[model samples]
Target: MGDHALALGTAWAGSVQAAGFIALPRRELTAALVERAGVLLDAASGTGDPAAAGAVGRWLVEAHFTHPSTLEHTLTVLGPALVRAGPDRGPAVLAALARGYAAALQERTRAEQERITAAAFVARTAAEQARWASEARFGALFADAAIGIAIVTAAGEIVEVNRALCEMFGRPADEVLHRSVDVYIPADDHEHRQTLRAMQAGELEHARLERPYAHAGGETIWTDIVLSLVRAPDGAPRFIVAMIADVTERHRLETSLRHQAEHDPLTGLPNRTLFFERLEAALEAGRHVGVCYLDVDDLKAVNDTLGHDVGDHVLQTLARRLAAEVGPGIGSGARAGAGGSGHLVARMAGDEFVVLVERPADRPDPAEPLRVAQRALDVVRRPVVSGPHRIVVSASVGVVEREDSASGSGELEKAADLMKAADTTLHWAKKDGRNRVARFDAERHRAAVARFELSARMPDALEAGEFVLDYQPLVRLTDQRLVGVEALVRWDPPGGDRIGPDVFIPLAEESGLIVPLGRWVLSEACRQGVRWREEHPDTQLFVSVNLAARQVREPGIVDVVASVLAESGWPAHALQLELTESDLMGTTGEPLDALPALAAMGVRIAIDDFGTGYSNLAYLRTLPVHALKLAGQFVTRPFATGMPDASGEDGHDGVDLEVLALLIELAHTLGLSVTAEVVETAVQLERLRKLGCDTGQGWYFAPPVPPAAVPALFSGPVGPT
Candidate 1:
């Protein structure tokens, strides 16, 4: 058993060495492993169990023999040793050993994958630390590494060169030593020299750059050069150490990967990623930049008509023609000049492309962008030939230009903003008619930006409690008595004044935020109404909350409303739910159907902004509504021509009075009361009362006030005078 173990361990060590596991001496490693193998052989032969074999595998791994070949070689050597030592049980023992080693190897593979993932996560910071910590090993690595190495004085004169460095440059040591390191750098590569200068001046501690070096045979050798500055014991600068790795094949692979990543596979045009990179560079260069965003017209229609194959062909052909007309080696009318000014054409997305032009800072030309836009339009409108098919394709272009400033400040417009404006302008061009160009308008962009900001902040605002409700009094138009208060939701964003409902309400409704938002308002209004009712038992005031169309359409709206009423302990009759005319107009939907069930529970329903919608008065009769809230426009339009006299009786002319009277009569005939909104002036108030409006609300009584001020408004018999 002892001789068999010794033989097996010696063979295993040799196999590991062959597999590149030579960290320790062969004799020492074999002697230690033999002792461990003796224990494994006893267990495998006696018990026929693989536990000892697993232990041996772990021991091998701990000694850094974890390569795939190490396991293969271990089994190959140990199997034969077992067979020779104990022929009767050799095959069984060998099988157990193989299973144990394979199991442990699987664990090692998983551990190694995890280690690689962790290493990649912190590679940059870890690399810097490792480079600095290995200073003592640097001498040995520099001398023994297969790659090239050189030590140069701070003045850029080479002081020493290793054999590998000489072989890499194809030159003798005598010919390379004492020469300026800059001789190897290409003439056009001034950036490389600047890096060296920075290193010498201590502006940088270490740097790596892939650059071409002049070889002895008049050929160029691409190398990844890692240069680090060495300092004296007292911290003064000493010399520069450079490690050169020949990365010709690596460079080719990298270039191919970059091309694949940055170009459209089908069209072979630069993609959105590359376009933004060029745009950023142009912005950084402080040059006047312009972009002409283009979209192929009716591409989807073409795809649907003539299968996608021909559609793809059309795009490819168009791309080729566009590139041929306005790219390198072709007579592209638009070109770039010094100061990093240039033109780049890229595919923004499916059927959309953009041509970016940069004008030299010294020559700021306003007409350049217009000329490029016209040229691009002309190029795309030409007919394209995809195989046997001749497809006529046209495109719309949106052009945007920026003025060059000495500061190159991007505070006003950034790359992302610029791209968005171009997109909006492109949409404008498409709307006007395809096959044309449109320029960005500042006012239009501002409106779009404001809408976007309002929509984007809605969800966060709701979650962060940026929303609150203020109450506006609804009064009986005849007696000027406060009947109820309408709960108006308002957004008071952080560090900003209150944003009115007009700005963010429609925004919330459009973005589907009204469902959750409406529920919150319902709960809050009910809570406050219950408090007010409890405080002033004599007052029969109720809370009127407006519901958005989306809120009405919600399948769970009935449950949500019931939950709020139950939670707040507020009477259902004291809560008036207002829905827009359009919301209740969906005569056959769940919302209209749900109204009767809610009204039966003592929840009064009213059609708000009544006459502003296209819904007929006949449809109003079908709704389970108790009141009609005439839109503010009907009341305000009467006074628009001129206000009434001091008596407030002569505000409305013939048509205004007739319209208001007829609507009220119709509402009364349908068994519904009428409410008038926007009664700001006494003339408006007296006029609404004469028109038989049941209740009125406006700034005349009180603007929407916070919840804390509700007590004061209801403290008296009537609201604010």
Candidate 2:
């Protein structure tokens, strides 16, 4: 624990002292040299000597502190011997020797500290070395560092710069040292020191931005610089270290790459991804934004008529037109407000265009966004001459405006909502003959989505045993006696209330739920038909069931129908399949191949919704249709005047009278019986009967009731509702 024990600074001094001794010469030492060297060195200090000492004493004096142990021992022993020789010479020799050893110790201490610094520098990683924390030892460490690094003060002064920093700056580190960081910074960035100072002051601990710094030839080189604050443990500013890299090439490539990702090569506008990003950020930023989703309705016709090259030209023209309507993102402030501070335009996909506005003004009477949406619609509505084709492609737009806090991202919902609204409105636009803009309505969207959800769940409900057949008696048109019953599938989901097929059947077909549910209906209908036949042998008639498009399209539809018949032990003709126009649209994919197969199994196919689907009698021959059930639209409502017109065509002008005539005449021509749906009023029933309608199935006959109620219904008289 005394002076000989290891101390922080002295341990380093001791290590250096050892280093200095390793180089001491061990050449042939004559007794004369040792004695003479000792005498000369001793005499040089103060004592007179009889002879010279060896070179060891001189070596120790020259390279002071060299051979400290040896120096100490020799000085002690030799001084004593010299004292015996003479007091004057001995005392002075010892004093001179002590000074030489002390100087050597100081040199060894300096070397050890340098060695420690070099090792620390080498141990640092590449990233750390670039801007290592500044220390007084940095001067030595800087020279020893493998990568370039620099240190700057808050006032932008480059103090104690490193060699790597110099190499990065392409100048000598010393020359670069003490220069204002502004010397390397461009003039435009001179006022931007607040950023760096803030970082140094611990406001921002780190920052990375590429800026051009002047090099040796005044060559402005782009550098990717990471600046971080070197702070004391108490969090006060020590220095700012700029770990810079020459990223000129990397920057060039990255910029080139960013353009490729964010911009379209053809139109050079923001792609879908970038457009949505801006829309989402705008939404998140809580601004009033608007979006005009537009699609060129005529683009398909344009491509068909004028080749894709000219079609592309029209699209390019359309892009330019949109650009004129709404300014392209430009300038910093302007780019920040690119979509008009609240609006953005993007090609959602295909010929469809989406003009997005983030700032959807929440004013109940807001008109600016509406005006912009109208303008965008009008801008693209104009005719464009693409080469030889004068393509008159009008735009259909669905505009949606919502404020930032609109519940969700609003992009997906808004885009979909707008597209649907625009499509529905655009249909009127088309019927009114093209070129229009429409804003979205929440209620309409909600209604449609509700309907869609209802439809999509039906088939699954049926599979889960939620569907039951409700039988409505089909009475004899002449006698008012119940001949058979029509089976309607009803949904009564467990843990919920019951819903009629009217609520979900159409939906099931649209969402492809009808494929499975339709099979259920047919199978159950036939089973019920057989039960009725057993219950009332006198009422040995048929049961009619409705088929959806998805069911008709099912690959096993015919097999399912035949299986139902076999399982029910009911004749195929006793179970009638009532198919609407939507059903025929799907089944026609294979030329009525399924119809013929079902017909061979004695299953009768009746075309439901006949006149409404615009039936071309020429193609009806291809179907194995046993009967035609006129569409309810043509057989009901105010149009059902139920009177024959001058043409003797059963009042051939309205829903019931006129359409029924066309239906009956067409059915008679095809040797098929006609069943009028919804024959409610006596006038309509009598009209259909006169039109030679062979059978009637409607509320005019009986209302659908429970199976238990059916027995009571047929037990008595059954007639029009």
Error of 1 at 1 (Å): 42
Model 2 over residues 1-721: C-alpha lDDT tens digits?
2221122223333434444453433332222234444454346445444323323334454544334354444443344344444433444344444444344443443454345334433333444433434455666665655344677776678886666667777787678778887666666784456677577667987776667777888777776566666654455676676655555543443454355456554566666777767766665665565666677777887778778888788778877777655654222454435445434566556687666655433423246556766777777777888656576767766665663213564533453443455555444444455577665665655676677677666656666898888887776666566666778878888888888767776677567777777777777777777777788777667788887666777778787877878888889878788887556756344454577788887877888878777466776876788888776766675344656568775443444455557767877898887776777777776666666777776776678887777776666557743
TM-scores for the candidates: 0.58, 0.63
lDDT of 1 by residue, 1-721 (tens): 5787787777777776787756788778788777766866775567445466656656666666655566556666665566555544544455445445445544554454334223322222422432333444545555566567788888889997777788888999899889998887767888998999898887888887878777888877778676768765445566787777665533443454466557776798998888999888877887778888999999998899888999888888778867766542123343434343356788878899898877667877677677777777888788877777778888899988764222445423578878877898898899999899998777777787789888998999899999998998888876777789999898999999989888888888888988889999999999999888888888888899988888887878788888899999999998899988778866454337678888988899998898877557666767788998889888887776555567854655668768888999999999998888888887777767777778888888788889888777655545434
Task: Give each model's whole-structure lDDT.
Answer: 0.75, 0.62
Q: How far is 189's C-alpha from truth in model 2 (Å)? A: 6.3
Displacement of residue 563 (Cα, Å) in model 2 is 2.4
The deviation in Å at residue 611 for candidate 2 is 4.3
The ten-residue window of minimal lDDT in model 2 covers 1-10
